[model samples]
Target: MTADPRRSRSARHAQPSAQRAAPAPRKEPITVGRIADAALEVVATEGYDALTIRRVAAVLGTGPSSLYAHIVNKDDIDDLLIGRLYAAIVLPEPDPAAWREQVTGVYTQIRDLYLEYPGVSRAALAMVPTNLETLRVGEGILAILLAGGVEPRTAGWARDALSLYVSAYALEQSLVRQRRRNQDQEWVLGDEELLDRFTALPAERFPQTRRHAAELISGTGHDRFAFALGLLLDNLRPASG
Candidate 1:
């Protein structure tokens, strides 16, 4: 049977619309881990400042409300980020004879790792670590202190101090990095340039600073970090014999 011209035209027009009507395939379910991974990607590509619930949700092809089902809020995401990063570290066993060194080493590792994800350390400033991996790192540090004879009270307080220092330092570095990128600069100012600037200061007015220009401008970050760690450990001596 021959089709009517009007019916044929109507069916031809309807075919394209029908083909487009297939429901969008089901999106993979969002999970806490998936949300955290998307958030980290946001952080990696656009610094921590750019990370937001909407931004991460967009990355996951979902809405912010969907993420709420799996994670609490931005703070929760921050904790997850820290937990994710530290989960990769293989902590050394605590040793009494080497506790100070071990603790310092761990702190250095933590600082380096925190620095890797810009702005993550900012969260570390106020967030008490309740995440499993974060707690594991804290436990390792505390174990070192206890093994070395630090009293429990002192060790607890020291943990707070160390955490504060690492977070502050990492935050500072991340800010500086962000500033450098925004300013379109390359390389941190070299020590010699810093020394020259300091050395050029009027000796009569800033004699102390001028005299110590080399000392003030010297030392790689690691050197300064080791010195600071040493100072902290020295003052933390185990209850004076």
Candidate 2:
């Protein structure tokens, strides 16, 4: 049977319309969460020092003015970034028997996170623990210390010290990694080279360093980190009943 000319023509037109490329996906709306994600991407790729309000806006394909609706400024972005990072840490139940290990694990987790985004610890160092997530981490640490029978004052001070040490450690590692990336490797010497330099120092001016060069230059990977953390925790004597 011969097809109707009108029907054939209509079918031809409908085929092309059905085959047309799909419309472009709608742009996702900007939100505080999206802003935080874009800001973190900036830090993860370009380092925390490279993160800025304009940069995050650019990353999200928007203008700085748009980001202001969600974030107040770069400081605000820092808080958001820190909160996001802290949110990833799993707080342990305060176990009096394992409080020391729990505390170390928490800080180690934070240190690892900071190292993942080079120089991110700089933001943490500058930030006060005002964000809920940041405060939560502090609370978790304090709970563990208190459960271990550490004095309230000592636990408070210890929390501050641990936070400071972790940030400082991560910052130092990030700086060293940055230097190496920039091909400024002279200051990032190998253990043997560092030991040699320590021993080469004037005997009178650096007697202890020269004598203990190997010890000073020791600690592979995070051995020094563990050792220092131990020193801080070991000194805390649980309050006697």
Per-model TM values vs. the true structure: 0.85, 0.86
**CA RMSD for every model?**
3.6, 4.1
List where candidate 1 sits over 4 angstroms from the true fold. Answer: 1-24, 184-189, 239-241
Per-residue lDDT tens digits for candidate 1, residues 7-87, read: 988887775743556588887999888987897898888888888999999999988999899787889998888888888
Predictions in order: lDDT: 0.84, 0.89
Which structure among the candidates has the greatest lDDT?
Answer: 2
Candidate 2 lDDT over 184-240, as tens digits, reads: 567778777888889999999999999998877777648989888999999998998
In model 2, what lDDT does residue 5 have?
A: 100
